[model samples]
Target: MTGRRVAALAAAFVSVAASAGLAIVAPAAAAPGCEVDYAVPSQWQNGFTAAVSVTNLGERVDGWRLTWTWPSGQQVTQAWNATVTSSGAEATASNAGYNAVIEPNAKVSFGFNGSWSGTNTAPRSFALNGVTCTGEPGPSPTTTTTTTTTTTTTGNPVPGDAMAQVEAMQPGWNLGNTLDSTGSDETSWSNPRVTEALLDNVKAQGFKSIRIPITWGQHQGSDHVIEAAYLNRVKEVVGWALADGFQVMINIHHDSWQWISAMPSNRTGVLTRYNAIWTQLATAFRDSPGRLVFESVNEPQFTGSSGDAQNAQLLHELNASFRDIVRRSGGNNASRLLVLPTLHTSSEQARLDELATSIRGFNDPNLVATFHYYGYWPFSVNVAGGTRYDATAQKDLTDSFDRVYNTFVARGVPVVLGEYGLLGFDRHTGTIEQGEKLKFFEHLGYYARTKKITTMLWDNGQHLGRTSFQWSDPELAAQIRSSWSTRSGTASTDQVFSARSGAVSAKTITLNTNGTTFSGLRQGTTELVRGSDYTVSGDQLTLTAPAMTRLSGSRAYGTNAVLTAHFSAGVPWRINLVTHDTPVLASATGTTSSFSIPTTFRGDLLATMEAKYADGSNAGPHNWTSFKEFDRAFAPNYTTGATTLTPEFFAEVNDNARVTLTFHYWSGATVTYHVTRSGSSVSGSP
Candidate 1:
């Protein structure tokens, strides 16, 4: 995802030596005839994305090469959809794998991201297959043939449950490189102009959502007021997408100048600008249907000399401010679904905690959590087809989703997958090929459907053609559509229970799930009554005294207990716990732990630790002990002698489950040193 700019030709002169009075030239026969559409779709001041399409009007060709020269010394830095080579001002592009063949009257295209100084212009002449094209070159074409058939918006009822709505929003597409371009014009980034026909094409292909990442900072004035013209343009594009029956998401994107991490020196101004931007957007879209969503920020994070604690505190405050501003903006804005991004939109466990903690206690049920997934970065982003699309890659994808589900979805919160995609690197062809792209899409689609997470694919004028109004790879497009329909049964409801004091006592309990009737819920074989038993509201189902008494046998599960397992001597073969029967929670491998059990499984659990060696012999699950029996300690700084660091070392062995150690020293005059632990050695910082 780079920026784009419109391509302009640098004027050049074609000359010949004046040897003879008159130079006689014979008219050529039916040589190769072609037309070229060279465009720079996105650009920054120094870089741009260049896209070219060549149509063969003459005989068929199995392979083709295009050669052009840059007068402004623009260098091709990276390319996709073709193999490109540059030497000085001249550049040549060869056909990649799937696009090698060009039938009569058919077209082939490729693109590249390039850097420039002075001026950026398209080559004056393009020689396709060594025969110069006949089409005149200036700016690229502005329109595509629209389909006669159009589908109107259904104005579907907005589901009260955010997660349910997210599930309904299946496969999605991004209008990337166009609006999100760092350059001036929307088309500066090499993508063709956005048209009604394009929106129609996307909806016709079964995409349920359109994510428009727009950079608004560049269009604002010194007073921070967005330009009227720019707002109108955004409205026009948004209207097109919504008219074509697509859910649309718009956000403030790529504003690096104003985006700073949690630092007191810069935070106040950042929040002010954020409020200004969202207030305008919210007011404008207030009358639009509920399908229109406002994302607070693309990826919010701190920059320069900021610690994790400070950034975390700032992110929390920023998210709360975003929520308050939109709500106060009035109109439909009060109830409009808002998306809050985690730290850097990351899916890491600790980052998830940071996001959840920051936004906790908000009463707005319409708010949906969001994060970008580029799990196993190398495998998912800018990757070769060969390295990805394997079993390992599949595991990485699933594991990432599982973490998201456990972190947010398992609770009452809903999550939107704002961004996820394969970088589409085809090695042999130097263009996007089928196999890996299809597999990645399938995994994305299947995960979205099963996990009930909304997904949007990132496109940068490659996989799908913005000009042709057709998929560059038809099979890949079909795979995405097919995977969208591949889903399992309805997701199971996660219950929130309550505990009472006495046997057969009466107390109300709430079920934290999207609505179902009182009779719909049962404890073992007993059916509960409506008003006499429980009441329902959104995802909360509250049970009455009689119903609670009847359901007394069920333990109310709340409060998540964390399991911290530390390996010092050697890693275990496997970690196990027995309640109903022995179940292996995780297989140990590394020097640390990556396993956690739900807090609901809190009472009377037994840990059966086991280890296996390289020789294939297994150790015993010999340690059978109560989790509660483990010692929990707390101590303040105490000095034993003069001029010694206080509380030098502390260690705790929780049965055979985990071991934790810490060292502390007094900040002031008190100094002491000591170590507590036996039969095991340890080393590390305080």
Candidate 2:
């Protein structure tokens, strides 16, 4: 599983500004005029990253080239969004294919990583297309002021009790993959534009708060000025949520990784842009009630820092600046509840401690600590043979929550789980088994409630259908809702497997009563007799042989029957009666470019695959673990009756080595096979 919450796009924008104290050279009247903003956002002992934005002030130019002479022996090591070449002390950058055109008064930006000597100073002069730039653009254009009318009746008055206000914002929902999308617009990620009706639908579903994650980089222009249209759109959505009585949270979403991550090197530029963003936002919503919360940054992380210690210090600086700007902006922001996150919004002990220190330093009671939880790594993405929500996953959750609870909640600092969901859910809901996914949510909700951490479900139009405004899995949604109030009983396994060719034996499931009493078990509307069909002793629910055989009608493969375990309260647990046998694998010959083991699943479902060499070392991609990453190194196609080993897996494995493959099925059956690769040719044996 990945450590970051969201996968960052490659072409993220960095903060840019013209270097001050740099000498300027005047160009001839016939020469085209240009202005450049050269900023180094990240710098270390010997390396640094720089972002450059060049604006054409002269006639329209179809293509542009920027040249600058390093004053302190800085060398361009690598670059992106533009092509940079260095010779001696001078360096030149040419626009990439897409950004080749520069309309009159328009700007284009690019970034690069470079090396520096003892003293890394900004370049003294810059020339665009052989013409020396004045370093200053023409007079500023007229700025339009959007006057927002303040309505006292919009939201509840700002509450003095921060803890109480945070508690009231329980059961939050995230409007993800919408405004936060880094594409051209909100709909760039295929989610519809935010509508008041959508907010109404979310409110109807018991969500008291909404997190609007907006990526402001793409919508910003030179000098880090956010476009008026984009700012207005965000305000419109925030207003809708507030009008619907939602505690709204708006933050610098993707921009955290985009530009904010360069704070260590470009502290001046990053802080300047960051302060401008918050100043505008604070000014816009200054009159709004306290329900409007401002999060400093989403998953704030710093690159090129000395270490975690330096990263923590950088985050503190940003948080401090954010708080200072918002508070001084006046109106409701003076005492408005502000949320600050640790590095990457992680719940680890170190990250939590750093956040606690920052909060204590602020000495503000209206402050809240924030973090994100995406479940345990392996089970989250169904990697490393972790296909179940076992003790390990449970312990991970409890330990994380316990640390945060002890560090903050117990000490009177409110905590908000800014985002919570399985990482695999982002790919597709079925990436993890339905039963295991449900159990995870059920346990997560209960534990978070006990810890007093408000969880905002990160729904990127996967769990909930945006158009229909209904959950794809109503049962999963119901379980999450129930977990908010009380704990729900769950079974060890939601499935019972019976061999198709043999006589069925009794199947027992360990129930986690979780303080709830089990009512009975039923298949559809027919309730099974307790003595004859099943028996419940203590926390064990056992299905007799006769009942198992009856449930496995015709001894068919796959799910034969679905049984619901009803509890005295909360949502019922589903128990699927499946008939499956040991899966069969066949030998095959192919090339490393493409290879697959013909499989006869025989009604069994594939769980995960493990690959190991003769030396007992891991093989294939993610070689640190014997079990290859799901869907990346290998994928099971039930319809094709084959398990395909992707080229990515073969690309990493030794060319002429034999690797043992173990296929694990959900039915608890494991099959071993061997495959040998010679050059590009491969052969498998069962």
The best candidate by lDDT is 2
Worst ten in a row by lDDT for model 1: 5-14
Off by over 4 Å in 2: 1-160, 426-430, 589-594, 678-682
lDDT against the true structure, per candidate, is 0.55, 0.81
TM-score of 2: 0.76
Lowest summed lDDT window (length 10), candidate 2? 9-18
As for model 2, its CA RMSD to the true structure in angstroms is 18.0
Under the 3 Å rule for N, CA and C atoms, how many clashes does model 2 have?
4
Taking the tens digit of each residue's C-alpha lDDT, what string does model 2 give over 520-627?
999999998998999999898999999988888798788999999988888889999999999999999998889999999999887888999999999987665788
